[model samples]
Target chain A: MDFIRQVLDRVGDKWSLLVIAALEAGPLRYTDLQRHVPGISQRMLTLTVRQLQQDGLVTRTAYAEVPPRVEYALTSLGRSLHHIVTSLITWVADHHGQIREHRAHTATRP
Target chain B: MDFIRQVLDRVGDKWSLLVIAALEAGPLRYTDLQRHVPGISQRMLTLTVRQLQQDGLVTRTAYAEVPPRVEYALTSLGRSLHHIVTSLITWVADHHGQIREHRAHTATRP
Candidate 1:
């Protein structure tokens, strides 16, 4: 149950899911992840990536160089998560407009 | 893209996913959703449910009965979400242990 809770929490988190989703195309550097996921702050990006790394869903690699370089990528585990989240995304796109109109009509009634 | 972001945000939220996951069994009242999801406060539950309802992921029904009665359930939309979330849960359970140990081992060495 705890495991389910954490997974739900991780997947449920705004930053983490977008981070995972962002990496679907391929590996990205820290800057790339930030740019790819809009509305994400530097702090949130760092925190979420660390959380993902700890969860073993993301792997971070650092390159020893003059300018300093770091990259983040999905492990196989992360890639698998994409399939799950993608399905949810597809479901939402399929249904959200109707749901919104229903709520709008219901709210105006009283 | 906004739809994807909102859907991601909704799913990424802690309370909403659990609330949706809990409802997989059947419909429940507001209080019932609270009980099913441990650690959820009434505020978050109400908020998350409203968000889900707005997103068309959850359907709320009110009965004109003495003392007032209401029940919430997944629209076909919500049920479709169950399929998506279940796959995520499965992925977590399948991999969490190994991931935890990997983090632990790496943590101590560096």
Candidate 2:
């Protein structure tokens, strides 16, 4: 249970989910990922990617080229997580309005 | 997008997920919830419940009995979130070993 909680803690964070989702289509260079996931600062994107790689959810590869190229891709574990998080993102998108209405109603209660 | 992120931030925390899962069968009192979710400090349970109530995910009802009774149950929105989070929990449980192995492999690398 503790292990499960730890995994959830890693994957459930906002930036991590966004970064993982951005890499769902395929491997991406750092700049590509930054562009794909709007509103993520470069520092946050860096930290999120490093964390994901450490947790074994993402793979980072660096090329031996002139300018140097690094790409991030989801491992199989990451793909599984992506499937689960996509459902969550979809649920939030679908019900956010209702949740907002409930919050409004709750706030007005004295 | 920001709104969705905020909602995820509320529900994605460890204690909140545990509390919500504990309420899945039915409404539970504070003590009952504490017992249902092992290792949860009273302070964390209180905070999680309050946040859930504020977000309109969990509903809290207080009774004017001799000792005063309060019960928490999932609202429709909470139920929706529970459905999504359950999938995540299941995925984590299923793949935790693989993830552990990956972490071990990564650690041994230079």
**The best candidate in terms of TM-score:** 2
DockQ of each: 0.56, 0.73
Q: Is the docking of candidate 1 incorrect, acceptable, medium or high quality?
A: medium
Q: Give the TM-score of candidate 1.
A: 0.81
Interface RMSD of each: 2.7, 1.5
- The lDDT leader among the candidates is 2
TM-scores for candidates 1 onward, in order: 0.81, 0.93
Question: B1-110, model 1: which lDDT tens digit per residue?
Answer: 66556666766576777787889999998888889988887888888888887767888899999989999998887787787776766676687777678668768865
Q: Chain B, candidate 2: TM? A: 0.91
Candidate achieving the largest DockQ: 2
Per-candidate Cα lDDT values, in order, are 0.79, 0.84
lDDT of 2 by residue, B1-110 (tens): 88988876777777887787778899999899999988888888888898888888899899999889999999987887887777777777788888788778879989
